[model samples]
Target: MKITQIEIYAIHLPLIEPFIISYDRYDTMPSIIVKMTTDTGVIGYGESVPDDHVTGESWESTYAVLKHQLAPAVIGQNPMEFEKIHEVMNKVIRDVPAAKAAIDIACFDIAGKTLQVPVYQLIGGRFHKKFPITHVLSIGSPEKMANEAAEHVEMGYRSFKMKVGTEVMKDVERIKAVRERVGADIAIRVDVNQGWVNASTTLRGLRAMRDLDIDWLEQPVKADDIDAMVEIKSKADVSLMIDEGLHGVKEMREIIAKRAADKVNIKLMKCGGIYPAMKLAVMAEMAGIECQVGSMVESSVGSAAGFHVAFSKKNMTSVELTGPLKFSKDIGDLHYEVPFIELNEKPGLGVTVDEAILEELCKFKDVVKEG
Candidate 1:
């Protein structure tokens, strides 16, 4: 079936609390949601939560691209031709992965619904029906961070991702306190969001937390600095996972060639959507690099897409799709059992969207159909 109409919504979802990282703070997440209606009466959904600091995209730009370029490009095209759809999007514009991701996700959703299988089956089948989720702790004081970890532990969460990349010694203390509070059994990872800015500071930070048993350190330096990543990996005892530094396959190849990182964080927003994300996971598996499916603090519509990717791939050893947990309300249904997110057997992303809720949350809306 061919896609006939695409609806775009610009929404602002309030976070339960202010989410602060090394570079920015957010009390609300702005996202662009896409609704694709096909000729045979099948409908599909997608969401794009762009981060200017991460994907070099913002809500306005993402919405603009979806309405003016990507949505129109996909009209009248077959939803099953995922590769061709991506090629057309790339030709229309470049580097707005978040914008392209929305259309891509919607396309996958329609394909899955039409094929009568889940999105995971289309990719690689389900290796994990339910995976452990790493609840992200925003940047805070040592005591505060430790307390938050303890609280999540009491809630049955066993894995935690702590935000760092502030002061080196203080960041060390923050991890130390959380480790002490959570004990040795709980899994703890760190994400700097490229806060260190250089090899020396990252090395110093890694050295200070050498004995803390951090599962891995993520993106300590800037995104483009492959040389610094190589230097930090060579000098430090910590395992590095590149997040901000990785986007497409080219960057993945560079990271693999340089031995810059032990792991890679694949977010749909970073690499476009499920289609390219699966490719990245395969490339990482070939390179023997473990993968983590990360989120851009999306609602259930987006997080469900990520969960499918994380569950389908064997190499996606870690998951951080806890964005739904951070939001007070969502437009889709997702089941969260503290540390794990479970998926249903419904076709496509397997998410049921509440259109009324979506309308309520939308700040702007537009429809793109054939003229």
Candidate 2:
């Protein structure tokens, strides 16, 4: 059936705890929710979190593209024709992968609902019913971060990713404290978020942490500096994972060719959606690179979309789908219990919106249709 109407909503979801990374601090989740209704009466839902620093998208930009640009492109098209939809979406807009991702997820949801199967099954069938998750310890003082790590460990989380790259000495202290508190078996990962500059500096910092047994380091240098990344990766004592550096399969291939990183972090918003994300996962796997599935700190809708990709893929070595866990009021029915999520049997994403919160928090809502 063809898409009859598309609804877009802008809402700000308060975070359970204000979190800080290398780049900035976030106390709320800014989301653009996309809902598509088909002629057969099946409804599909999707969510997009706009981060100006990460995806180069803001709330106004995401809303404008979805309404003025992407809407007319696929208004009356069949959701099953997702390739055609993606083509039109790209043709109408240049960058704004987050906006395209929202539409892409909604289309996937529609297709899965029509077929009476989970979105993971639609991708490649289920590889595992429950996926492992990694809890994040926001950037803080050494003692505070270490204490947070201990709390998460006590709560049954075996893997933890800490925001680092502010100061080499502080980072070293932070990791050492956490590792010492949690003992040797716990896995600790760090995301620099492009804070460390140049190969020399990155190498120096990584060298300092060499004895700490850090599992992986993410995006130590600026995203576009492939040569610097290559040099740093070669000199680094720990395995390096590229985040902002690789966008999709094309970037993944280039990074692989350059031997820039040991692994790659895949996010639904960065690559557009589940379809392209799956392709990227396979590409990384074939290239002998491990993949980490993450998010832009969105709600359960977007988290569920990420879970589908992570669940269906075998090479995803790490998961940080802690978006729902971060927010105090998640706008969906999906349940999250730290490191593990039990996927429901319902078709599509299997997440229903919390209408009460939607009405209270939604700033804008609009329906798009064919002209």
Candidate 3:
């Protein structure tokens, strides 16, 4: 079916809680919602969260670009031409990756519904029904972060990804203190959000935390410096996962081929959507590298979409589906009440959005070619 219309919404919603990562604090999701309508009357929904610091995409810029530029490119194209659409959108627009990702996912959802199958099954059948989620504790004092880690552990979470960037000593000290409280059995992953100035500093901090047993050091240095990344990966004994470095499938392959990283963290918003994320997952798997799926602290819409990717990939490693937990308040009750979601017998992605929550949480709605 042809995609007849593209709907773009500028959603302004407050975060239930302020989420502090390495670079900055996010008071709201500051995301753009994309809706694509097909000639056959199928509808698909997608969302993109732009990282002002990391991705350089803002709400006004994404809305203007999508409405003025990208939307016209695929107006009459086949709805399933995600790859072609992706290429056209990228070539036309400069670097609106987050906006591109929203459209990509909307198209995928449409294709999945058109075929009467879930998005995961469309990619390849099923992988696993349920995935164990990891919690991302916001950046705070060492004791506060540690206490938060301990609290999540009490709630049955086995993995925790903490934000570390501001003060290197504090970041290292927090890990050490938290590890002391949580003990050796629990997995502790650290994301620096590209805080290190150089590889030497990254190595120095990593060296200090060596005995604390960090599960993985994420994007410790800048994303562009492949030389530094590969070098860091080679020298460090700890596992290294690249986040900001992933520009596209080719870069991911290059890193994996060169052993630039021990693991790869694929985010739906960052990679432009599920199409590339799944491709990266399969590619990483073939090359004997492990990939973990994460998100941009979006609402249930984005989180649910990510769950499908994480759940459907068998070669998938640990899941970083922490948005639901990171948010002070989540929009929907849909995640909790789904059939076959009991880790078995789940036929599809195992998620459906709650209409009431959608109405309540959304500050504004953008409808394209509304029926």
TM-score for each of the candidates: 0.98, 0.97, 0.90
Query: Considering only N, C-alpha and C atoms within 3 Å, which residue pairs clash in candidate 3?
Result: 101-272
Top-scoring candidate (lDDT) = 1
Q: After TM-score superposition, what is the CA distance of residue 224 in candidate 2 from its true location, in Å?
A: 0.7
Q: What digit string (tens of lDDT, one per residue) describes model 2 on residues 183-228? A: 8899899888988866877888877777888898889888888889
lDDT of each prediction vs. the true structure? 0.91, 0.86, 0.75
Per-residue alpha-carbon lDDT of model 3 for 216-274, expressed as tens digits?
88998877777788888778888888888886787886897788987888888777788
Better of 2 and 3 by lDDT: 2
Model 1 ranges with Cα > 4 A deviation: none
Error of 1 at 146 (Å): 0.8
By summed lDDT, the worst window of 10 consecutive residues in model 2 runs over 333-342
Over 4 Å off, model 2: none
Error of 3 at 199 (Å): 1.3
Per-residue alpha-carbon lDDT of candidate 1 for residues 69-121, written as tens digits (9 for 90 to 100): 99998899998899999999999998999888898899889999998999988
Query: Which ranges in model 3 have alpha carbons more than 4 Å from their true place?
Result: 328-371
